[model samples]
Target: MSAARGGLVATLAAVLLVTGAGCGGPDEPGGGTITLPPLPSTERTTAAAPAAAVYRLSGNLCEKADQTPFADLYPREDAKRLVATEKLCMTRRTSAEKSVSLTIDADLLPTEAAAKLFVETGRRLAKRPFTDVDGAGADAYWDGDQDDVKLTSYHGNLVLEVRAAVNVKDGMPDDVVQRLVRVAEGTYAKLAP
Candidate 1:
């Protein structure tokens, strides 16, 4: 072949090779290399129960008191001088069994006076007919109505009553309730004089 014809043929072959590689068609080896975009760094927050979810009265008192400092009433000195009594029972529910707990505290009051106060409170509670009284001490609970749990604590002359209702379905578990009871008792003990 002539030199000019040979050079032209070589140039044509190189062009075809370059075009085929750049096209990246399915027939081409390695096809098209794809690199995915990076994932997002922002975190997603899920809904959770409030820290004081077990305290039913917390919500109502927060609304009713409107930011009052209720903790001030249960001081350490008062708790030390206070005496506690409690009662416990089971509820009358057939489908789901429940436990009740009731506790009352009185400071500087005579034993008779304290007993009178507890009796009166129990009578009133019976009229309202809430949960059964389980046991008593510095803290107590009525574990009926799975959603609502009643709690009570006393220091000196101050009586703190809490009705914590589990607004969410399936509420808190027994272990959680037991933990909360311990926490409540500790808090009450801290209020001692």
Candidate 2:
């Protein structure tokens, strides 16, 4: 072997001896045990769950709302109206094809538990057929029977209502109902954040 290779082999042999490695014979050194460094782990790691979002109750729900979702259905916003100290905001938008109205009513209770109680009580008293909707807000529902699409949700101390005016139609179409759901979600973002 080259001088360099020979030197390397000699160094390795010395290290093996120091580390209690055997000389490859029945008569071995130490306990004839060899301990190698641990190999890299092959276990897969999974991502943790996302943190839940806490939505704030806005005083003026209309101002913080994102109207982009329903802009196509209702192109123009009606004349400005007075907002009740951010407690209530009624945003009315109209287009040649349809007119839509979204009402956000908020009641700031002293405590979050009180707010929840009030919302739950109101829901119970509604009596009307309500279909629970997912992800509209903390709690959400829609009218089971209606000529036009209407969706409602409660977040914190605020209740959001998205209503579409289609009185002439015999019943609400699927597209209209889906549109209302989207509108409710978009409006909830504004009113509850």
Candidate 3:
């Protein structure tokens, strides 16, 4: 396939993998059971309270991501797409004419209860297929195809979605994608008690 065609296919797959309006809500479009791990003990503190509003920022959401992995991929100066209150952070790094890109979306909830509901909704989404990922967070799943990686994780009062697409013709590496997921999960885990 041409590079452009491959990139388009990869982008579509990433969109589908990261579906649910960035909420990863239960309304996943594909039909498959999503087995989610149990919420963390720290997340249960506010289970009895009413759900709080989901947090959405208007600035650079990528700033919340783990910088270690992305630091080299997207340099600070070149990756500074936006540094404001935007909820979506998308950027690409290019070298020798090859480029790799990523998009990160984080929804911070006002309460743990709200976070749980947000995550549970994604778990219940009968259409989206997700495999329960162990040792990642309170609940987590890794969704991917031939071209992209999308990891959805929830912990404490945070729900995070990490998506990456490398040079489409060359394809993205599994380890690279896993590292991004780790970054997303670890970053959110720190927010908990």
TM-score of each: 0.32, 0.56, 0.58
The 10-residue segment of model 2 with minimum total lDDT is 37-46
- Best TM-score goes to which candidate? 3
**Candidate 1 lDDT by residue in tens digits, 44-68:** 1234523321121211121132111
Q: Please provide, for model 3 over 1-193, each residue's C-alpha lDDT reduced to its tens digit, 9 standing for 90 to 100.
A: 4555755766776666557445643445434343333333434543686443344444345555564565554454344653324456676655554555667777777876787788778756524466666555566776666667777777667677777776568667547656776777665543333
Error of 3 at 166 (Å): 3.1
Show model 3 residue runs off by greater than 4 Å.
1-59, 70-86, 126-128, 189-193
Per-residue lDDT over 1-193 for candidate 2, one digit per residue giving the tens place of the 0 to 100 score: 4555755766776687656555444442212444454322323113454444345663555676555666776789877844534566667677776566655455556545565676666555565645666766655666645555566666655556666554454334456656666766776565543
Residue 182, candidate 1: alpha-carbon lDDT? 51
Most lDDT-accurate candidate: 3
- Model 1 segments more than 4 A misplaced: 1-120, 127-143, 153-156
Candidate 2's TM-score reads: 0.56
Clashes of each: 28, 2, 10
Ranking by TM-score: 3, 2, 1
The whole-model C-alpha lDDT of candidate 3 against the native structure comes to: 0.61
Order by lDDT, highest first: 3, 2, 1
lDDT of each: 0.36, 0.58, 0.61
